[model samples]
Target: MLYFVYTADRPGSSALREELVEAHWAYMDGFEFHARGPTLSDDGETATGSLHIVDLPSDGAARAFVTEEPNWRAGVYAAMQIFRFEDLVGRTMWEFPGPEGERFLVTGAAGEPVGDGVIVHGRLRGLDDGAVHGFAACVQAPDADAAARTVRDGRDLTVRPWCFGGRR
Candidate 1:
């Protein structure tokens, strides 16, 4: 199964995140990742969180990944949301055809299934347990509005400026 691990860093934890980068990378090397990167600020320089799409065995495996991750273990993340994901595009970020100008994480309870321009798309896991809930996506778009338009389903549509994550 594929799991999307969205990790939001604690405020003012950049220094701690930087300090654990090596350990984090080394730990992540053990998994087969679909797409991974840090969610960025509007300026595209400051990282607000980390997004990782990984293929694991079960929901327990997904939880184990987060619990053992260096950054998560070191108290870098203020919150973490894990979801069961589907690869609508069926490709990784490296294979995305869009120009790397600006990107956004547009997610909500999807009413209609997404068709195109979706770099990554999947369903969000329930907070109570591993039950599947609404859908989500990470898209490359010109702006937040455009990104939100890509997934025209569900209430409380949130559009956050994002970028390609992970080391080049």
Candidate 2:
């Protein structure tokens, strides 16, 4: 199964995060990911949180991945959101090809987007109950409005300007 893991670093934990980045990356190297990256502050420099879409065996494995992550285990994260995800795009974010300006993380009660500029997106479900809950997407667009337009099924949605979390 695929799990969507989102984590936020506690305030002023950048130094600790930097100190343990390698350990975090090394731990992540053990998994197969559909998408992974850090969510940034408005300036696109400071990391506020992270997003990971990983394929694992079960919900317990997903929880373990979050709990055992180097940064999360080291007290870097202030909050975490883990959801069972169904990949609608069927591709990793690394394969995104165009309209290169700004990006956003749009997640909430939405799914089945029929538009372009979606890097990676999917339906979000409760890991425990296995019920459909919401959706998440990494979008590339001119602005937040355009990004929001890409996922038409959302009503209550959050569109956060985001940076893809990996090598260029």
| C-alpha RMSD by candidate, in order | 2.1, 1.7
Clashing pairs in 2: 37-165
Give the whole-model CA lDDT for all candidates, comma-separated: 0.79, 0.85
How many steric clashes between backbone atoms does each model show? 2, 1
Top model by lDDT, which number?
Answer: 2
Q: Clashing residue pairs in candidate 1, if any?
A: 37-165, 38-165
Could you tell me which 10 consecutive residues in candidate 1 have the lowest summed lDDT? 108-117
Q: Write the per-residue lDDT of candidate 1 for residues 1-168, one digit (tens) a residue.
A: 888888999999999999998999889888887778888777777789998889999888999999999999899999998888866667877777777667777767654335456777777775347576777677877788777777654577877777776664
Worst 10 residues of 2 by lDDT: 108-117
